[model samples]
Target: MMAGEKNPASCYLDERTFRLCCRLFLQHSETIQDGWSWEQIKGTDEGFMKKTVLIPVQSSVMHKQHGCFMQAENMDHLTDDIQSNVEDETAGVQAVCEIHAVLRYEYHVLYSCSYQIPVLYFRASTLDGNPLSLEEVWSNVHPNYRQRLQQGPWDTLTQQVMCVTS
Candidate 1:
């Protein structure tokens, strides 16, 4: 074995699975234009690395205030009068709000010489430089995938709480 080289017994990731995972991520996020773009970097002795860029997300009126709750004195008379012009007009609110945030997901795929299966390692973070907690990440994931994500045996590297699934 050479320096920086992976052991033959180590389990690594495959190329096809990596590509499929990338496509699935985009499909679920639905905000690809806003971010979630990926780039393939040079391959290392172990395998390949894919980096996903960070994207920002701002809070909306609905998110802040939840929803409007109106009480009418008369059900019959209020029905006709409820058609008043009510503009949410979040321009001013958005200007002063500090709830702006960004999201990014990265993938590292390696080929395991022993197991001979592809191993995928991924990490997600915010633009503020704060790494996301497992719960926070889990909440954003689609329900169908949440169960699998939680059950999967993931290896977390130092400073990065990544989830690795075979």
Candidate 2:
């Protein structure tokens, strides 16, 4: 094996080994700054378990006027839209309210016997635990990941192995 890589296919994920894996992984993450808290969770699989990590939402931002996050180029279009809705007297400038929202993420990793690899299932939610829609989740993922997701299912086996937090 190489540094920072785990050979998942080389090791069988039985109940005992899965428990140990979760413990060791959790222990290692605890030493890192701002590490997301993880816990061992029981799975429906006869011989395997899962590791779940929960990241809580930290804050909510209120925008001065449409409470939205606008890219530099989009601001010009937004200004035009705002001006069109108002009288010519205020055509050049207008005030809008913007709101920026953040979400919490929950991830579960389990060994899939059918695929012979580990699968990571994650979801984004509000502070109260209401889940985000598929479209919203797709939008939230980094653009680089969008293509990987479109490739197919079970592709996450490799994707999970490649994911690293900076």
Candidate 3:
């Protein structure tokens, strides 16, 4: 309910409502922005998948803009390694890519069904998407999120891509 809070469980919308909201938000963003776009694709579940990208303008500081993909997964969808590696106790997962930053970060949120909380499973990397040593990633991430990233796996989900001008 509060704006700009760090907790995902605090999100009032449930999964179905959240997906619908995402679609609607994407539609409005397209009308108001020159370089933002998103589309829904079929999902493993009855829900939908969404991929969004925001390209920067000529005056922007970052030269490259990378597309980010986010999707949710139920407990049954997780791999054995991921299931075991994630320390958080949760019933669902949300995965996201962060290639737009100077360092790439790939993280998953595990939603605790009972508590309605979201726990982060995260890892970061160098600009080329090469896996950083745990120490390296530890130093790069903010102090607040360091614990989550440190507790999670070492793989990154995003790869560098050239900006598309057209």
Candidate 4:
């Protein structure tokens, strides 16, 4: 691109422009080692976003996943020895927030030929690389996005990820 040339303003972004934008952003970030990387569609010039981020899971949430919780007094010693440090709940206990595990999010941004728009797609997994299903992903969506996803784009982002996959 020439110095006088401007960034593409249209919805359909060419691969060259996409590469340029990625380079610009990566250069700005100045991180030689980063989670964001480029991936080709194999035997084609088409490319898309791929980013992985680690998110901390609170002990409370992990606890809920492990089993049901009753009154603190009724709580047993529970030899499970989970991430929680709330040893004594007999007299109304307080617990510090602890990270049970770190979740890895694989994100993607691709131009959809069918929808004629850029679509977002992402999935979360454990550090061990166990991919979470779409149902698991939807179950954890924030309430705010629940309303927004009823419309297009967002609904397509998570569900219609066929933009690139298909």
- In TM-score terms, which candidate is top? 4
On TM-score, the stronger of 2 and 4 is 4
**Which portions of model 2 show Cα errors greater than 4 Å?**
1-11, 38-99, 110-119, 153-166
lDDT of 4: 0.52
Listed per candidate, the RMSD to the true structure in angstroms reads 13.7, 14.8, 17.9, 11.2
Candidate 4 residue-wise lDDT, 14-103, digit = tens: 556656877776665446545566678999888887776554443343344433233343223322222132222222212211223444
Ranking by lDDT: 4, 2, 1, 3
Candidate 3 backbone collisions, by pair: none
lDDT of candidates 1 onward, in order: 0.46, 0.47, 0.40, 0.52
Arrange candidates by TM-score, descending.
4, 2, 1, 3
**Could you tell me the lDDT of residue 80 within candidate 1?**
28
In model 4, the Cα lDDT at residue 65 comes to 46
Off by over 4 Å in 4: 1-9, 31-34, 63-99, 133-166
TM-score of each: 0.39, 0.46, 0.30, 0.49
Query: Using lDDT as the measure, which candidate wins?
Result: 4
Give Cα distance to truth, residue 156, candidate 2, Å.
4.1
What is candidate 3's TM-score against the reference? 0.30
Query: How well does candidate 1 score on lDDT at residue 127?
Result: 38
Model 4: pairs clashing at backbone N, Cα or C within 3 Å: none
Q: What is the lDDT of residue 160 in candidate 3?
A: 34
lDDT (Cα, tens digit) per residue for candidate 3, span 68-162: 22222322233342334233312222221132223334443434456544334444543345544554444544678767755753543223334
